[model samples]
Target: MKRIITVESVTEGHPDKLADLISDSVLDECLAQDKRSRVACEVMLTKGKVLIAGEITTTAKVNYIEVAKATIREVGYETEDIDFECRIHTQSPDIKHGVDNPLEIRNKENTIEKDIYDMLGAGDQGIVYGYAVNETQNLMPLCVNMANAITERLTFWRKNKTVKGLMPDGKSQVSLSYDGDQLSGIVSIIVSTQHIAETDLNELREQIKSRLINDVFPEYDLSRTEILINTAGSFICGGFDADTGLTGRKTQVDTYGGIARFGGGAFSGKDPSKVDRSGAYMARYIARQVVTKGFAAACEIAISYAIGKAQPTALDVVVFGECKLSVAQIKQYIIENFDLRPAAIIATLDLYNQKYKPTAAGGHFGRPGFFWET
Candidate 1:
């Protein structure tokens, strides 16, 4: 029997995206003012209340409430009909310890006070994975690429006002049927979009089908495609109003869209000191280089670090049975060519800068160029 694969994506206006935007925005602010700042902020959103919580150690002063409100307003949730109003609450204080300074920093710097006031380490210790596949031209899988394209076009039309009555909150899911190793056809397309209260559903569906969907996938015959719009009816009240959102909830979307295994670590709202964030970025960088250099059909790299430790406790590379070189050789190449240390990854990826917000939406790894560089 042929296998069917699917991938899903959410629009920038979705509640989860809003929370990610706010979290990254806070990160950006701190990094903009102080590159050495350590931050791990998470945001929760519900109707009229945006709760900001997390730990941070930075010389930069950040107005968390301001960032939250601006993010919501930017997503087009300023209407009175919406239940959420972007009001912020206090950050969680429990996770604040390591953000202040870890033991290694204290031992190296001579005192906790000096370490806290000087350098900072990862907020936590954990494993993270980065992956890449040759199934698509962009080094991403087809289903995920299509889903991201939908969300990207939706945002583009909304920002340009080309699609009037389109609200910010939306989602896209694409299921592709694969016969052996080759893609056969699209199995389904699911989209849940919010719109103005008075908009016509039929017309809205037709517009999305004709303009965005049809234009993007012209090679495929969409007559057999299962296109669904707002399967649960009108999505008038969405964003933080309809559902609560938190940072790192969309980790799968942020990475490979379930096409690969996840390390179960969330990337948003955490500083580069955390291996969960930095190691993941480094892993992706390594995987991309591996695939680009013709070493594998797909690659997933994993790395784990101990708290306050510069060297990773564990490191491994998997090629999904498509290795051109031995896995051990790939591992050796990574060890020799890349720096897995938390501080080193940040410096290499330039993660200490204010570029987290743009990554909140869209697939992070498959994008054209580094937004941080731009």
Candidate 2:
């Protein structure tokens, strides 16, 4: 039996991504000055306006409007933003107090480092999932890997001027076919791009086919590949001008692209103290470690937490029965080896010092040099 699945990715200039970048840039600004900053910044962008609305508590003095426009400019948006608003304020104290003192635990007995793991509650209450598979070298599904590669290359071409008339606002999607999990072939390549108004569409399509599809989609057989360029006609109406953008809107693109379960949390604009970002990253690290150690061909981990508590409320591991070790034994090994507390996760992944702007754009899990990916 055969199955087909697809995954998608967008460029940094995509509206939602632009919003995410602005939000993360604000977070970066705060973390740069005050490592203990508590932030929940959200950004919205449209036509000639940018609105930054959220809560932030930090000793750092940041210029919110400037931070936002600078982020848009970095993404290659050259529009004149004559109207901007900053509705940011210090984070809610109730939440802060909870995070500062959360220390709930199970059985009241533990061996993990207490200094970092004790008395720290999850920044918020939620479930977060981590997944790893041997389908690709990076433990990511092949279609997602290909989709990201295509979009990333498109951005590189736009920025480097290697591809004529390309703009930063773009997206890529790939359809992959599988025969009982064994790779079969590629079904299609879809590219939507924002480009110069005066460029020739026919010529543009040919250029993209020759440069991007040929270069990036060689991993699978393309003997019957159907390349679709700008299916909705010209994409000159893009960026904030075409739509409004908000932070945390691209979580699917941010993670495994539906190949794995997401815990209904977004990563951007939250400090490492927040389990949404730190916990998710830590979960990825754990999943990858299990796969790298040959404990499983694939692993999926679920972690749940309560507000103002340092200990996980629950831990669930599913290894698809591909391992010799029992799930219970594997769970015990993880308990003894790794720390899931917010502070411990922060320290282990070096989450606070990350250059979040890069992460805001690319798919977060598969990238190398990232502590989670390691």
Candidate 3:
């Protein structure tokens, strides 16, 4: 018997995603102004409230509250529907370690700076996996593709007013059946959406079925595939009003969607110095290169680090038993060809100055036009 795999995605306006967006927006702003800024920011949202907290070291002075509010408004939330204003509760403290120099001269001006930029020290020690498979054209799993298609369509319809009265918050789940190793058919699709209270459920379902679902999966047999939209009832109030949200809670959604193992580190609210963020990006870049170069049918790269260390403790490669080269050879190639240090990865990928807010939703790894390429 063939097995089935399922993956899910959330809309950009989903509460958790909203929080991620806010955090990344702040990160991008700081990095845009000060390329060397050290920042770790977190965002929390609830009914009528937004809370900004975390440590930051930057030369740029930002109106953090304005930044938060603007991010919320841009995501389709207005001041009228449960005001999403923010309050900053804390600021980062100065590091007191004396082993490193405290003052340096740049452009003939003396300044207090952290000069440890060779290998970004791990903000916290953990593991992370970067995966790429030839199962799809983009090297992503099919189930995730279906989920992203549905979520993107939802956003598209809302922006174009093709589906009027549609709220921003939504969720999509796709179950794909595979025979042996090849994709067979879609098993089911589930969409939970928020809409204006006055909208008719039956009409909304029909519109979604025709405009969103049918458009994305044209070859799939919808008559046999189970479709559910807001199966419980109407969703009048959503976004931050419907539930509370915190940064870094949607790690699975942000990465490979549970199709592969996770490293238990959140990507948002941390600077590139944290290997949890930069290391993962580097791993994905390497994995993609490995698969694109025809070294393997699929690749999962793992790198482990120690706190305040300049080098990863362990570097590994798993090809799902589909590699033309031996695992040791693949690992040797990566170690020889790529810079695995945290700071090096950050610099190579240009993570310090890249805008990351756009990647907070719709899946981060598979998206085209990443800043690293530019």
- For model 2, how does the per-residue alpha-carbon lDDT over 171-231 read when each residue is reduced to its tens digit? 9998888887677888888999999898798888888898788888655567798889999
Deviation in Å, model 1, residue 15 alpha carbon: 0.7
Q: Write the per-residue lDDT of candidate 1 for residues 182-237, one digit (tens) a residue.
A: 88889899888888899898888989888889877988987778998888888888
lDDT tens string, model 3, 205-286? 9888887898999887877788888887898889988899899989888888888776878888666877778888888888
lDDT-better candidate, 1 vs 3: 3
> In model 1, what are the clashing residue pairs, if there are any?
48-84, 48-85, 50-87, 53-91, 53-92, 54-92, 122-273
TM-scores of all candidate predictions against the true structure: 0.88, 0.95, 0.90
Residue pairs with clashing backbones, model 2: 102-121, 102-308, 102-309, 120-310, 121-308, 121-309, 121-310
The weakest ten consecutive residues by lDDT in model 3 span 96-105
Q: Which candidate is the best by TM-score?
A: 2
lDDT of 1 at 98: 50
lDDT of each: 0.77, 0.85, 0.79
- Give me candidate 2's TM-score against the actual structure: 0.95
- Look at candidate 1 and tell me the lDDT of residue 29: 88
